[model samples]
Target: MGKKFFEESELIINADGSIFHLHIKPEQLAHKIILVGDPGRVSLVASHFNEIESEVESREFRSITGRYNNKRITVTSTGIGCDNIDIVMNEIDALANIDFNSRQEKENFTELEIVRIGTCGGLQPHTPIGTYICSEKSIGFDGLLNFYAGRNAVCDLKLERALLNHLGWSGNMCAPAPYAINSDKELADRISGNDMIKGITVACGGFFGPQGRQLRLPLADPNQNEKIESFRYDGMCITNFEMESSALAGLARLMGHKATTVCMVIANRYAKEANTGYKNKIDDLITKVLDRI
Candidate 1:
């Protein structure tokens, strides 16, 4: 029997033969990719490149392929949230592993090395503003991975159940069941350091109610943050909150790629501290990732 092919509707290639959402041709993709939440950050990362080979921009997705320290790298913006991550990770893997013309999976695919450098809110006192937290594991409140098959193969069931029990999770709560996935150990080791605090990061679905922020609308569980912050598993405590790391790590694991996240702390939820002037810190983080990645 012939190999099963991806349907046109499912694996979309633009008329110009580029990935649908990312708008990047397969050839334009590099083996190494750095993911950032802001589209403007694309240029920031590319600035460090010795020379750029290509640049593509469409909607919130901006991509630039260039050389850093003589090594080829592609930096792409994912905008924000796990929803955007779903589009970015799939299209990225398709670019590396799927044959656009044949619409078939490549027999031997290139495994991508992906690192996400972003800004996040610190959940713990130790993870203060200006701290760099390497995500050893990401807890997903986004409920994204539950939709995908074989998620259990990549997720940490023990961590999931532990969190569920700690929070007394129930289907009636109208919240997604939390899931956990670890970063690529080798990649994490390369990008992390003594200066960076390594811990579990919670990736929330929204910036408001989902993250325990109050405006006019009240939170379903006002104490959700307290419960999350106090929960402990395998000697690791929740350290930070971000929007993208969970989906980035979970999807990459399923796609056989190496992925991890290192975020600079811009706000401390516990301490009620925030640093609006975090661009310089982000630049320092970019330098660290560019050098180590």
Candidate 2:
């Protein structure tokens, strides 16, 4: 078969053969990547590295590769939302599996172990502030996955239908049809510790209206949080609300990579509790994830 060609517009690469958005080459990355929402958190995670190898930043995406406990790992900041995930995941996959010179896919695929460490808001009252939670399943309110073909093949249709029915969603409550995807079982098991809470996580598109936070503008569904909190399907309930996990897990699965999310609870919506002093808790969570990963 003839080698496939990618147009410059389609597969954009710098003159140095690095990916356009990330501004990083394949060699600068590790097989295991820790994705954070805040760029500053990249440095926080890399601070524990025994030896720092490389650090690169472009826009909101900051990547640092180093060795920790004799294990090579890369920590990259993905900004926020599935929009950034769309870019970051595709570029990371390209760097690992595509040859920039020929603009062709490699014969052998490189599977990545991606773990997202971020802050989240607990939806259930029982989930206390400063608690750590690992997502067994991520439900996305964003439509990024729907844009891609074969998304249904990767999603949990039964769970998705149940949630949709529970919400009474008829294309008016939200724009995108919600879908659920499970985390990599091995990574989930490895990342979950005795203290970590495991449950379904809802990835909202926005921080305010989408997450049921009231501001100057009225929300389309003010009871959104209540509905999400009360939603249960076959013993699975939504435990927390975050912005990125769904796309991360979904895209990782579609790209043949293993992925999971471990988040620190900074706020509890049901209890109306917010922790202003959670830095130390985050530090401890980071340490725990680093040790396990």
Candidate 3:
């Protein structure tokens, strides 16, 4: 037979009694999820967990579930960009919902709170290398959700329009696409820390030429990151740069799940900021965030 509808194949066992994808079932999750873009970082984050539970890996997807602050949670590696985010989010959605009979019409889903903890580049000089940015909103530069039905549903539409108007960003071939911010204010507020600097973050499409690195390739849009920082929606600011937060936030809101991303300032591109104790900052930031979350 072909692929079965409502099959939790990559979440629950299909062939035999086994956890699929990350090789974990719904019961393995802790309702609170912490995501990292690197598979190795999954274990790094889980090290802070109270109960050192099972560590499982499938492809770039590594998972460690345990307790922190007496709160149950799971840390999973989402690999690289929006494509990986798409996979991890969908699989996680499947894990949370129980559709054992393969039903299609019901739209069964269990709400889960997800937070992405990753490293990103600082767009503005104020966003120090040691700081963490909680996205108040994300600008979808990746077009990952360009095909989704409600593209701007998770974003600040007034902010988006204001940004476009302020930066005159509406006419470029790669126009600024809208992104979703976290819907739960309490969740966002509860997650912020000294290192957790919360603001708007732009989810770039690529790492090299797209993010404004010459890297031996022809230029499509040179000086784009600067242009990105030049963007503003009234007083609302775009804080940092990364690859996935926009789509993650957007899709999560579309599906009625709460999501946000907290990124470390590893590189400060403007003012030639590369390594001002960036590593030490990342190490401390990870420890602090994981301990609290």
Candidate 4:
């Protein structure tokens, strides 16, 4: 590592040449990365590795790289939300494609294969608790992609327009404008193994307010859950709700990387059921995803 070229305000890197937030170097990361929302889950995924190589941690982000069945894989925790995804994705891409010493992009870019394995609430009554499903498309209510350029080209404009029209969306609504994007089909297919249910996933900005979970505060749209449950476009129904998949899929597509999400249905909102003992299910999902990826 040499003297820093990027400004501290623009791009922050540690003295050891690791990225600021992730505390990871380019060589430590693998091309195939597994992203989870919980820092504790990092080791859970790495537990399947045949041999451990490296481990790094910074704040809520934790990373481990090792060989899984002779295949190199990196597992990292992103904490939560598209907000966190913004930071993690950019920094990871920088670690892979940016020359830290020169503060510029490398001549040859690396396209990462990103897979998000997490837990979500099933919106549909049919998708029961403890079910594992892969997202075919993700609808984002977080508005992360709106801040970036060239979003229209990466988003599914037709689906967005259809959803807007169907929902009677107005500027007055408290919800942010929604954008839809499809997951990388190749990755979804591989992860699903034709055994999991594939449906649209909605990524909300907040767990309570945006997800229509009313506790102490009232929602602007009280019928948000009902609306989402009834929403269908191109024969696809909204299946589940989570916090990060939309931005993961959207930003990955914009960056020319392959991304997909496989989540365990821990709660069924319509069925009024929740699985308190979902650790075994999650472990099984982790094994399945690790085997595929």
Candidate 5:
């Protein structure tokens, strides 16, 4: 069978031959990529690079390619949600394996090693503020991966069933079904340390209702956070809540790439504590990832 061609609307390339949303050319990318949520953090990651080869900025997506410890790496910002993660993951894969000029798949494949470094609100007591949490697996409350075909092929079905049963999620609540995806074990282990807590992470769709943070509006399940905190499967408990990770790990798995997320705990939902001055902690985390990746 012949390869299918990607439609112009589906695979958008700028006139300058760069990816549409990210505004990054294929050559500017690196096999080792670090994803950050805030665009401002891209520069911080690049600062540790010995030599920066290229930098591109468009919309909330900012990219920088450089060398860290003689290994070429690219640091890019993905804004703040799984929706954005959908865009970033697909385009990054396309850049690595698609022929933009022909809009077709390349004969050879280029597998990427992607790592997401972000801040999260810790759910477990052990994951208090200033702690580092490496997501061995991510629970997707975002439902971004559900839209794609073969989602279950890349997901953890047993874990998903356990989570759904624990949450008592029904169709009537208009809640998105939760899914689970394990991180690339090699990548997760590489970025983890004795001080880091390796556990399940929740990738939420929204900040308020999705994460049990009530403000002006009321949540359908007021005890949602409590239930989530108590839930466990195969001795793995959900460690923290973040905006990305599930989609990154899911899409990367489906695309035959290595992906994982490691986050710094800036807030503890269990302890009701937050560290607003988390810059130093994140800097330390970045250095750890750079050295390991």
Candidate 6:
């Protein structure tokens, strides 16, 4: 056989049939996807997959595609933040779209459903830690896609302007913050009763200093997290705080795909979530969500 083009190869796969970062090929991926930020969590996710099929590991991205409820789904790691999410999300889409021989888009594309099974600090205290919460809405405090659309279009113009005014926010940066996007209904229904808490709010952090966190230095806004929780628009409170949900939601909607997230509350702004070591507890949550998802 002669040399193959990019589409002929999984870019992520080797001619020797070794997997790339995820180290798995087309057969390893399922129509449904589950994403986590940590590589270690990938094993936790894969442990739940039924009818063990295949596995791959590259860099921080660990992936396993197998059967769950007889449904084929791929579980992988996104590393961290929107940049990583953007990369993994696109690659997964490409795997299903392109011919794996030529890099060209397929004549008929498949819109794979994705669910981010990660951990986050929830703004709503009622959202207890260890609970698997789904993100019906996502708001980026990180400002990733701030320039993509009109500021007044998605959310309340009055609130945005009001917050700006109250903060005395004058701008060299007047770009619009990303808006909320709901997850896939079909997928959501499938996993609805599966140890999952639906309707979570995801917060994207601008950085350490601003997300109500101070390490060696002082913080810019001590009450920022509270402000996020305090604001209730249309009874939809910011459910949880993370770095990628809003961007994922918005981008998924724009791409004509359905995306949703179920996150474990690593920390709750309010003193409600059972006080336990963050790491191990989050592990339990991830397992629960994946089994149900």
Better of 2 and 6 by lDDT: 2
The per-model lDDT (C-alpha) reads 0.94, 0.90, 0.72, 0.91, 0.93, 0.66
lDDT by residue for model 2 (48-153), tens: 9999999999999999999999889999999989899889999999999988888889889899999999999998876889878999999999977888888999
Better of 5 and 6 by TM-score: 5
Residue-by-residue lDDT tens digits, candidate 6, 1-293: 54335643445556755434555565567777888888887777677666778777788888877777777878888887887776676677656765665555677868877788777776676777666677765656556556456433444445455444444443726433434455667766665565666664645554465456677887556766666667665656667777777667656665556687777777776764545566776666656556665
RMSD of 5: 1.0
TM-score of each: 0.98, 0.97, 0.85, 0.96, 0.98, 0.78
Worst 10 residues of 6 by lDDT: 172-181
Runs off by more than 4 Å, candidate 6 = 1-24, 146-178, 189-197, 272-292
Local accuracy of candidate 1 as per-residue lDDT tens digits, 1-293:
77779999999999999999999999999999999999999999999999999999999999999999999999999999999999999999999999998999888979999999999999998998999999999999999999999999989999998898888785556667888999999999989966788999999999989989999998888999999999999899999999999999999999999999999999999998989999976999999999999
Clashing pairs in 3: 132-197, 154-180
lDDT of 4: 0.91
Write one digit per residue (lDDT tens) for candidate 3, span 4-118: 4654433455453334556776577777888888887776777677796666778888898888878888999988898888777776776676454453323555788888888
What are the runs in model 3 whose C-alpha is more than 4 Å off?
1-14, 17-20, 101-109, 164-183, 276-280
State candidate 1's TM-score.
Answer: 0.98
Q: Using alpha carbons, what is the TM-score of model 2?
A: 0.97
Candidate 3, residue 147: lDDT: 74
Comparing 2 and 4 by lDDT, which wins? 4
Output candidate 3 Cα RMSD.
3.7
Error of 3 at 288 (Å): 3.4
